[model samples]
Target chain A: MMRLDNTEIRIGFFGALAVAALATLPLFSQGYYLSLGVNLMLYAALCTAWSLFSGPTHYISLATAAFFGLGTYTVGLWVDHVSFPLLVLGGGLVAAGLAALVGLATLRLSGVYFVIFTLGLAELVRQIVSWTQTKVSTRMGLYVFTDFTEVHIYWMLLALTVAVFVTGWLIGRSRLGFAMKIIGNDETVARHVGIDTARAKILLFMISGAFIGIAGAISAPRYAYIEPPSAFNPMISFLVVIMALLGGTKRLWGPLVGVIPFTILFDQVSAQFPNHTPIVMGLAFLAIVYLLPDGVTGRLEQLRARMKRPREKLGEEVRA
Target chain B: MQIIVTGILLGGTYALIALGLTLQYGVARIMNLANGETFVAACFIAFWLFTAMQINPLVGLVIIAPAAFAINWAIYSVLLKPLVDRAKNRGMLEVDSILATFGLLFLLQGLMLLAFGGSYFSYTFLAERFMILGNPFGLNRVVAFVAAVVIAVALYWFLYRTRHGTAVRAVAVDPNSAKLVAIDVAKTAAFAFALGGALTACGGALLSTFYTFNASMGVVFTMKALIIVIMGGVGDVRGAVLAALILGITETAVASLIDPGLTIAATYALFIIVLLFRPQGMFGRQTT
Candidate 1:
């Protein structure tokens, strides 16, 4: 029931326009560019989805790999029986369900405890999946053979990215968003003010989980062969967190700014200095934490405010 | 009986690993994700010394531990001090330290990878069997266990009996009050971090005696140490030892009783259960 600000409408219009432009990318470009576009959109969706919960709440969930892996394995295990679109939906729902369960158990735990639990969740799921595979079948990995080409995957990821952006925008303006803002500021105060902190957190977490799960499902075919280790890699969670933090999670579109550059950089690092990728990634993480703790957008915002202060002071003096 | 004996032996080393983390986290107040890297680095150093110069790991520790102490102290002062100064509160400090140390983790791991290559390295030092209570154990394991216990006892005595150690514990309990009381909170934290790193590296040297290790194995050890720290209650010296033993026994029991693959999963389940029932830790006082 909130009125739309002019800036909000303008931002939305430009966002839609950008998505339209991105959708035509695959039509013009083929091999490397197309693959890179897909990778960009994949992380864009993930970082945005991660920020949806962690940005506001400051919970820092490392469970993206868990949900993403479930979504991946959902497609890997059931592509033979189910349609692709249905599998994607199933993936989101399954991940959301897991998020709800985890949120109920862990939303109360704060600080490092929550962070480690989420990290362990991925390893736990990976272990269970690996063990089950050995027991159920001699095959170590599932093949995700789909007719979908790179172009198809790119456009699908684009759609998912747009969907996540729209969802984030909507949630940002809702009552739930207001509650989350309050909760983020101080959970005890929010509870004192009669806000149901647990419910709000779980709800937002579920939404974030669903989007991430869909992103994973959409990206599964890119691998062709899916295994527990790669699907549930802890590195994915770390990358998403670093990317989102780098861009600054203050705005809905902030993660995209980080996602674009980092994806390209990662691609180059993997290709050229493949052996030193970890070193490069580690350095980047340190630089981000030390130099730009508030992220790129955040630092920019600070600079802007500083720039505007002198002008405002001058105007005040003239008026006096 | 055999399983229990093996678990106890394993748990001794685990206690040392967890103790170092407790010092770093509980006293220094930095959740050092890179703590295990120190351990791994020591292992590699031990391996190199043994293979190249024919030096015993015990002899190697004399050099490596002090080096680790100096390096970690520099790391704290150069990298983490700014973070500590800038943070407005405990939560902010925790977040900054986690991210920063996470970066350090990969940095150290990658350096180790570049230097050591992606190969498992273990040297045959005291690979012979020794009998205890009708159960067979690796002589290396027994030696490592003995070393771990001696180190833990010494650490305990220092914390309880020494003045500087008391200041470190005071800082762990309440930095603000310790500062009010004219204690150098920052200095104590830095010293504790360095000492913790040294101890962790010492544990790694011990582990290198019996356990095969590689560059990437640091995260697993870090995770295990973290679980133990949380289970025993953060900052509680006695609790961490008990928790490490419990974790060691549980993991050993799971591996022997069920599938070995499920050991990590079982560890996760136990951790989640502990987090649910006792978020403050079994031994920690409830704080709000």
Candidate 2:
């Protein structure tokens, strides 16, 4: 019953093809290449999951690391007893539950307050986990034994990325997405128009948390050993944010576009100039913010519209 | 009793740091993520002065404060002003300013790291121990505490008694009304930023005498200042001081009573609790 636009159709087709290509990477690629693919997929999935809630609602959450870490620790602690799929689900549920609680309490605060609160929540969670590790386990890190091979992990990550991408696309087209756009543009106006802004925000926040948590859950086994510092590294939150913004948060495909190039950049920078990577990344971030505030996709969209305008004018003149 | 004394003393430094953030947020409505970095930069400056030039750390404040003011003024003029102007033209200033400041944070951190390699540095000056109320306290900490209190008092005086300070307050209270009254809102914002930079730098200079620090420690201090500012309420200077004192005491108490590793977590928990119960802050007026 719904009409699909030309752009949407092309995107859907290309998206499927891209996923198929990625799915075959594990079959052909080995060792470092497969691991690189997994890493790229992991970040792409995170950027997508982050943009799902933050892009539409305009709430810049720094809690991605918190949820991801929760999922990692959940898997780390319980992998022996539970099956892999159930552990993944459990990780998602736990993160969603925490997000729901945190959202209810902090969503009322807007702008910088929300950002700071989320950052604090992440730090708090990290410290608590660290404290627990020291107290209960007497060990600095947790090791999980997984029988899955590198290819299997790659497939799992690819599957998770697909799920996240699909969820993001579906959410973008749904009524909830419509409400979120309104809320992002103007919360007061959205509320006046009979939208329950708080409920919508909390739900979306939970959904975002669940996706990131699941990504963390599946990816945890790859590392074999997880420490609190690495598990809840705040840099993940910052990188995901930068990726989402760089790709153009307005479009569903923006993050993917942003992540591919940045992941490679990150890899190269970390390899060659490890200490200077922060400086390089920081400068790049500033350049993006100052020069391309709307991001790569937004700029491309503007260019397309500009090019189309002259043709449309010619068509009008001919008709006249 | 000793823990209480130490907490209050530590709170003095926090109050000084929070004062700078409070001024920026309250007056200019810029949530400066780089506030702590400004402090760290000043500390590094003082450290360089002390180590490289053999100058006393306290004396370095004379150079540090003015340099900090100029740097911050430049930041506002070059980076923030354009963004703020653009956002104002579009009528969406709040979110844009926040993002811009976030970018500025990374920029500052990166630059600091590049300029001064990541290594822990502390100023070794006036290192002495003295007994106070039957408890040994570091003389350097006592000096830092005293300097913090003096700076806070001076800031309070400036805010209450000076004409420029009144203008800053007026702009903070209502920019449109201040503009209607022929006050230059842009100039006021720049001045506020400069003043905030000086205060934070002074706080950093004082802290350098006592605390061990590195370039990456900026975010942690920034978080602490933010918590204090929020707990004290936006734009309420007195509340910021009170909140800082409360935080210092709470951290000390927690460290002493429980595990030391849990101190930061305890403070974050308190911050969350305050956010949930009193989002406007303890001393801020209610807003719908």
- In lDDT terms, which candidate is top? 1
Please give, for residues B1-288, the per-residue lDDT of candidate 2 as tens digits: 998999998999899889999898888777788898998988898888999999887788889989988988998898888877777432256656666777777778888888877888886788898788999999988988988898899888888999987898898889889999899999999989888888899989988998998888898888999999999998888999999999999999999998887877978878888977898889777885
- Show where candidate 2 strays beyond 4 Å: A1-13, A313-320, B88-92
**Segments of candidate 1 deviating more than 4 angstroms:** A1-5
DockQ of each: 0.80, 0.61
Candidate 2 iRMSD, 1 decimal: 1.8
lDDT of 2 by residue, A1-320 (tens): 77899998998899889889888997787988887888888898899899899888777789999999999989999989899899999999999998998888778667567788786677788888888878886789889899988788788878888888778777778888888989988888999999989888999999999999998898888879999888888888888888888898888878888898888888888899877766766766676768878889999999999999999999999999
- How many clashes in each structure? 0, 0
Candidate 1 TM-score to native: 0.97
What DockQ would you assign to candidate 2? Answer: 0.61
Per-candidate TM equals 0.97, 0.96
Which CAPRI tier for candidate 2? Answer: medium
